[model samples]
Target: MGSSSSPSGGGGGGNGSEKEGNSSRPRFFNKKEKSICWAKAETVPGRHPERWRKDAADNVVCKRLFNCLGCLCFEYDHIIPYSKGGESVAENCQILQSRVNRFKANKDEVDTTQLKGYSCDIKFTDKELDIIEMAVYGDVIRPGNQCRCRTVAEMLGKYKSKDSTAACKLPQSSESL
Candidate 1:
């Protein structure tokens, strides 16, 4: 939205800037507006058309998994930024993966080439996507066998397995890669 005026409500909520003037407009795009932003993008061929847009740095963004991290969950971005008087409407909205959006926040002058520089080049497998979904949203459907994967929280910082004995020690055998 290059012109003035913005929707009064948006679920994603703006960058939380309480600044006065044009910057004090609706920052985040609403659900309907988010969908409109997605609709404006080019879809990846042979992929789920409604769920997936064209690939960005080998990352896939699913509309249903908005705002999640790692597995390329995405958010509706302001193309021209409300802070600079950009309106909060479909024309000014663009969908960006969570990581990329965070890296590109509030910048009005970014191009597709620059987008690649701001993207993630890692490509994950289907099973990895499931694990990512589980870690981020804890909503993966495990078909059978009860396999426990460590949550990101447990994997971060200090971790001591409860299943281990009081004194846990690794074998001195160093395996070469």
Candidate 2:
């Protein structure tokens, strides 16, 4: 039998501030914890198994979308809320869509309805999804003929402009080539 003291367990720290060298629970999950959390959830097909995971709301979240402020993005969340005495560990971690996470804030909730209410309703085709992956991450998970959609830019040549703000420069149309 061991003894433990909870800051919230009918007691208060003097002045709520004290010199406790490295005693505070970690505010974030370590890489190993994150991996464990991801593995515990259902996997998705895109990219790699570890790159995608189902959020608490059951929405597919991509690690590539880390810190993004919308759907399909995710942030590591404290399942029990650190402020509410949750420890930072794999057992206490989850990935939630950015919007759902922000809305959830510090509340320890498992309500699928509340979480889903904040998710986006947009549906995307696989090629559009690949385009987004390219735009945001500069790499595509699906390559070659596997993805049937073609970019108008495809019939057109690849961009030659160096400046991002400059208009996309494609070589003269095939008729001129």
Candidate 3:
């Protein structure tokens, strides 16, 4: 099977064009966003950082295992899920092994409470947190001449600091009557 390709064409390798085609495809995350997510996942408290350590020759090797059960490999995932309006910002993104990402695909939310012995606390900037709250909990309803709404922080019973409130605004349906 492999020798047939070399014998038939043999000029430029078929693999070269295939690589170029793949390079033209759009990536889910840009370079900067990917680097940020990778950095954040590296600080998950109990995860093995050594998995990404540089080798003796100063080259880094990917040592990520299959899923949440193993060590870290780099696969970026959306914490809030894109289908649920989660933006591709750093806060909404996370790094998981390929298997873990596949297992968690497209779920609206991840129930971290059930993950025993795993202490997971992902840090988010105030603005990112606000966006998450709005996306997950903010509600808009038009009642007669006015629109009624509640912020995600309010629904979650968490107090929203004045700074956080002012930093992000909920989507306005019709000029907050």
Candidate 4:
């Protein structure tokens, strides 16, 4: 939050030549790094450095969250999970309903080793389905259904265009459950 009166003052050259050790100019500063954090100081006429900036692509929905039927509003939620080595990108984030987000968060806190069938469909073996009548239920309870509502269908339609391969696949039937 410090400011200097001189344009070439001792703090550091906000605008200086980067020709190695040309002068007493601070060696640490660079033009690109300065641009990223540079903000207008309210008290003065000079630029102040900041830690965060508004994203240029703020209008674009995160692809992964969009695919999961998430609205572009609010912070995105990681799908595969950052704890499991997922990266922080739109492609990895899934939009979740508030109720579902709460349920998943609570579920994560509990040990489900004794809670049989908690694994659900995606994890269930196709072979296991062949032997059980309830396997049909497993196939329907998709991870995608967490955001069940009209929003889900609308978002799914937009996402379907980009993910054409999955477009024809029928939604897992939730009627029986």
Clashes of each: 1, 0, 2, 0
Candidate lDDT values, in order: 0.57, 0.59, 0.38, 0.26
Candidate 4's residue-wise lDDT over 66-136, tens digit each?
11322221122334443344333334333232223323331223222322222222322322222221222
Candidate 4, pairs of clashing residues: none
Q: Which consecutive 10 residues in model 4 have the weakest lDDT in total?
A: 40-49
Model 3: per-residue lDDT, tens digit, 25-132?
222445566566556553322222433422111212233321223222234566766445555556776655443444455664555432211322333443333343
TM-score, per-candidate, Cα-based: 0.56, 0.63, 0.36, 0.19
lDDT of 2 by residue, 1-177 (tens): 000123331111122223234766555566677678778877765544545567877787777776666678777777787667776677887777777777777787558898888877765555555556556654444423222223557448763434333232222456321
Query: Model 4 reaches what TM-score against the true structure?
Result: 0.19
Q: Highest lDDT among the candidates is held by which one?
A: 2
Give me candidate 2's TM-score against the actual structure: 0.63
**Using lDDT as the measure, what is the rank order of every candidate, best first?**
2, 1, 3, 4
Candidate 1 per-residue C-alpha lDDT over 65-98 given as tens digits, one digit per residue, 9 for 90 to 100: 6665654667677778765777767888777777
Rank order (by TM-score, best first): 2, 1, 3, 4
Greater-TM-score candidate between 1 and 3 = 1
Q: How far out, in Å, is residue 77 in model 1?
A: 0.4
lDDT agreement of model 2 with the native: 0.59
